[model samples]
Target: MLSFNILYSQERNVYDENIFVNCQNEKLNWKKLELNSTEYKYTLISKNYFASDKDVNYYNGLIILPIDKNEENKNVIEELLKLISIEEDLFEITAIKKCEIQKLYYSSFLTEEQKIEVKNNVIGKLRLGIKN
Candidate 1:
């Protein structure tokens, strides 16, 4: 007899059960599906809260680093000084240089002209103060 039998199977939903046992024998189920649904919507909204441009994203932090202190080819100090043009506080500039010199973290975020202008401004300020 060539007879075919159809098998019946049901997909189990996680929310359908309170069979999970806690230490105190308490059973828990996904009773609040609405809360979970709202949570998903909230997540989607929150994701774009910290979104940023792709161009500025690559240099978001000091992810790449030099491992050797004596790596003579690394121009981290030069780059740090160059970028000091954008830094307002001397302490902040010093901190950036400190990280580079001590930890091998490196960054270069400014053009040569910017560095020259900054250096010139500092020199001009000193000269003006000295002349007065």
Candidate 2:
């Protein structure tokens, strides 16, 4: 089972409790979930499972591929940039980038179930953001 803990710049947090991926004999899972958005901004979380605490583990970095949703075919990266530009602050770009990067350790030391729950919630929030 894989799980995650996600954090947003708006002081919002989410979790993904259990993500199951079956392997040949045993299940392959992750301890933490990390995501890097297409624009090199916006980080998300993920996790993995293991047979025992002593088992060796590997880090799996999942990239969030750009999603095209505009008639001009604007992807997530472009949209994010546009959104950041709307802010009148002189350092809006740096601020947004920092926010995204800061999410890396939003919720560490979470249980497997808690991580999964957070991930699902974050995905829902992302969907809602897209809709709006």
What would you estimate as the lDDT of candidate 1? 0.19
Tens-place lDDT digits, model 2, residues 7-115: 1232234323232231112222323222243232333322343222233332222222223323343334444543433421112222222223113122354446545
Worst 10 residues of 1 by lDDT: 123-132
Using Cα atoms with residue i matched to residue i, what is each candidate's TM-score against the true structure?
0.16, 0.19
Which candidate gets the maximum lDDT versus the true structure? 2
Q: Each model's C-alpha lDDT? A: 0.19, 0.28
For model 2, what is the alpha-carbon lDDT of residue 73?
32
What's the number of clashes in each of the models?
Answer: 0, 25
Candidate 1 segments whose C-alpha is farther than 4 A from its true place? 1-68, 71-76, 84-91, 96-132
The model with the greatest TM-score is 2
